[model samples]
Target: MVKGAFDGVTVLDFTQGVAGPHASMLLALHGADVIKIEPPEGDWGRALGELKGDHCAHSIAFNRGKRSIALDLKSPDGIAVVKKLAAKADVVMESFRPGVIGRLGFGYEDLKKINPKVVYCSISGFGQTGPYSKRPTVDGLIQAFSGMMVMNKMPDGTPWRQGMIAVDVTTGLYTFQALAPAIMRQFRFGEGCYIDSSLMRAAAAYQGAKLMEWVFSKGNPPVLYMPAGSYKTANGYIMLSAMRPHHFRLLFELIGREDIANDPDLQSHDNRIRNAAKIIKALNETMPQKTTEEWIEILQPKDVFCERVNNYTDYLQHPHVKATGAVDWIEQDGMGALPVANIPGLPRASEHPPQQYAPHIGENGPEILRELSYSAADIDAMLSRGGVRAPAPAVKAAD
Candidate 1:
């Protein structure tokens, strides 16, 4: 049995929703003992989309491979339990609004006193010290504020957010990247650090090149390449990129528009951009004559970078996807079977069964309490007093 990279690490996770939980989930998948501290009701992420028992798609996707304990932060007993956990944790993460965790006595500064080698990470919307730091925000709000909506404008020029929680997921990845290096530094130098991660910063970093282009071009960046866009076909759509001059020429020739390919005015990329309307109009008139699959078959052999616009179902069932083992089907507890995409650098879900199970709310409370040296009576008292919560015993089927 080979150990994972973080096999000896312990993480105390007090974050909810996508970003923070996503980072902790990655840690758990890497064999860290991640203790997810949630409110009695559960992490609010579990309420995203349709709920299935104590889990939702978003929650399960971002919270697998972690033990859970539901606790009321306002209660003294709950705070004590967290403090005890913090003392032994190699890492601590929270996603509270600025100053809230500090007031609760679990901020980086507070925890550093008890455990100097703890790498504490705080994730927020606007970061720790800004005028908008306290302003409540979610993935959509960050998308709007960070110019992602503007960047991803519809053809009609309407600013629209992405269909998915792009900013939140990206923030989670950035947070994990930050934490990994900090943990390495701690192990090497015996010094702890604080990570202030935010959706705003992560979103900005994600669009760094675009921002630079905006500034350099004074908000009028030139088109990257000519004849690079999605065209409607008879059946559906095909996105093609004839970025290089030779590719552009080849595309026109393949479409049986030899006159357009030979046109001197549209030979260069700059001229093509200037006469984009002409090129687009020609493509629009011709593309509808063929189905997306037909166009793919015709253009792919000619070295055109083209792909059929696929929905989720199409992508999931793609032959290449299956051949590459890109997704693994797992029986998620309470949620039944689901297709889990394998992370590029991590082991597949089938290789690590424990990492594939997402815990229900407080699902491991009694076991965690026992590890913390709490007696059965004390654990029962905490549960009875509403300071802690554990899942109800499962009812057996009639024999």
Candidate 2:
């Protein structure tokens, strides 16, 4: 078997939701042993979207490549078990409110005492020392707080949150980026570091260019390219980008608007932006005359950048997506067959079967306890006392 980049690293993950779990999942994918510590019930993420037994799409998506062990943090045995794990962990991640993890005695200061070289990461909606740090927040809240909703305004000019958990997922990517460098630093210099990541900051970073544009333009940033936006076709919508003057000319000429294409007032990009209303009106009047596919056939041949606005199904079924192996179908246990998109720069799911498995609540509890050198009786005692939880024994069907 090939060794992974983080083959020998061990991550103690105490994060339940998308952001923290996403970062830990990336670590797991890179060949780290990520031990997910859940509550007695399960990670709250497990209930996100529609539940499939103990897992949901969000949970399955972000928690793959990790072992789960449910523990009651309030219990003495649970705290003891965590401390033991912390002492040996290369990285520790938590997504609790600012002081909640500290109060539970698993804070960076607490863990660093036992393992000076542990890379501790804390994920939250806001930074640790912010005025709004203690305020409860979710992906949508962060989207609203970070100006993403405003930036993603609807056609009717109403601020709108994205259809997906954009902020949470972005936060996870940022968190992983931070962790990778911190781990590298730790490997080089025998030192540990605390990573304070938050959805608010990550969302802002994701819109960094937009924020700068807003500041530079004093809130009225000029349109990027006049003839670049979604337009309704006879049957469906098509998004086009006529970024260059030639492309704009081609688009207009193809759409029977050669007059607009050749107008001196719209030759330069800045001039086009100034006359956006005129260009947009022409497109609106003409684009809907043809179907999205017809428009693609016409515009594409002229070197105009345009594509049919595709939904998930359309994207999944696209010939280019299949030819490139962009998505792989995997038979996820309990979830039936699932289409898992291939992450860039990583091996396909078929190449790493173990990394494709997302654990059920406390699915690896007994095995994890055994590795901690706990006797079978001790494991049972903890389970009975609610300090730990493992999957219930499967009842055999009688023949």
Candidate 3:
């Protein structure tokens, strides 16, 4: 059996985009019965994705352990349905713009009235009370606005957003942390509070060292001081992070050059900066004498740290990943094997298949209302009043 930690908690997840979804993804894996609340046409992801065999591959990957419910909160009937669902829910997560949910009558305050103990978490761009609270943001935009981009730019000076959505991941982890404490609060004191987690803020927090220096010292902390990043070798690049002075001494000695190591100008932090270019040039020249393998063999023996940067495919196929059983595979009807990256402790194989794909718009609307004990007449009335609309594609088997 797939044993989980959060076995009995019920989560009404209204999060979408990246960060919020990843936060709930972890909860679902740990056995929270997360009901994803999509709009009548479904979450924008299902429609706005790059498709593969039977679904949006990205959405399927991230939302593997949750159930879906399509609801149109713009309508009074739909909003009332949500209030009822939230009444029994232990947690409610929403990533809407600051005032959007309030205008729709499903804001944290409104939900709190229904369930005063609900751990309500709001994930947004800037936060609930900031000047940019309602600024529409995506991962790339926030990376730019938060200065994460500048910290990891190209040698030529053009900043780059990372290949994957880094800010989203940071924000998601923050959301999970916030929800955990709130859930613990409910268990300990019988009350839960709201968490205002902003993806922009989390991204900035992750890059605080670089950001703080720019704000306080007015420039980038030198590559020489932090001694962060890669050095080219005969065949590939090996990372170096000799942030401490003693380590710099050890690293210089390993490269077979102790002349500059104890030189008066390179002896201390301030002295190193006064002679930055010379130190960087000597290290670069010495690095290429050995391949990454040779450097690893030499430095690791002395405990002077270094690592080879691996690409995503390499990381997924690495020995540790396979040993940990970190990825799960499924067989689809016509498509070849689909691999779902499974977090540990979830049943690797089982009677229940991986969550069948993101639900079509309103595909589960009726069932969701019914689960909340809504009468058939009430559901029909809501539909008649435009509380929900089924996606035309869902009506047919294929799109």
Which prediction has the highest TM-score against the true structure?
1
TM-score of each: 0.97, 0.96, 0.81
* Regions of candidate 3 where Cα sits further than 4 Å from its true position: 1-3, 47-49, 53-57, 75-77, 209-220, 223-227, 244-246, 256-264, 324-367, 374-399
What is the lDDT of every predicted structure here? 0.91, 0.90, 0.76
Compute the lDDT for candidate 2.
0.90
Q: Model 2, which residues run further than 4 Å from truth?
A: 393-399
**Model 1: per-residue lDDT, tens digit, 164-250?**
999999999999999999999999999899999999999999999999999999987777887889999999999989889999999
Lowest-sum lDDT 10-residue window in model 3? 390-399
Tens-digit lDDT track of model 3 for 329-350:
6754333466666655456633
- Which consecutive 10 residues in model 2 have the weakest lDDT in total? 390-399
Best by lDDT: 1
Kindly provide the TM-score of model 2 when superposed on the true structure, using C-alpha atoms: 0.96
Kindly provide the TM-score of model 1 when superposed on the true structure, using C-alpha atoms: 0.97
| lDDT by residue (tens digit), candidate 2, 1-399 | 567889999999999899999999999998999999999888999888887677778888999899999899999989989998999999999999999999999999999999999999999998898699999999998999888888888867799989999999999999999999999999999889999999999999999999999999998767688788998999999998998878888889888998998898999989998988898889899989999999999988878999999999999999999999999887667678788899998898878777888988888999999999999999989989888876753311111
Q: What is the overall TM-score of model 3 with all chains considered together?
A: 0.81
Instruction: Return the candidate ranking by lDDT, descending.
Output: 1, 2, 3
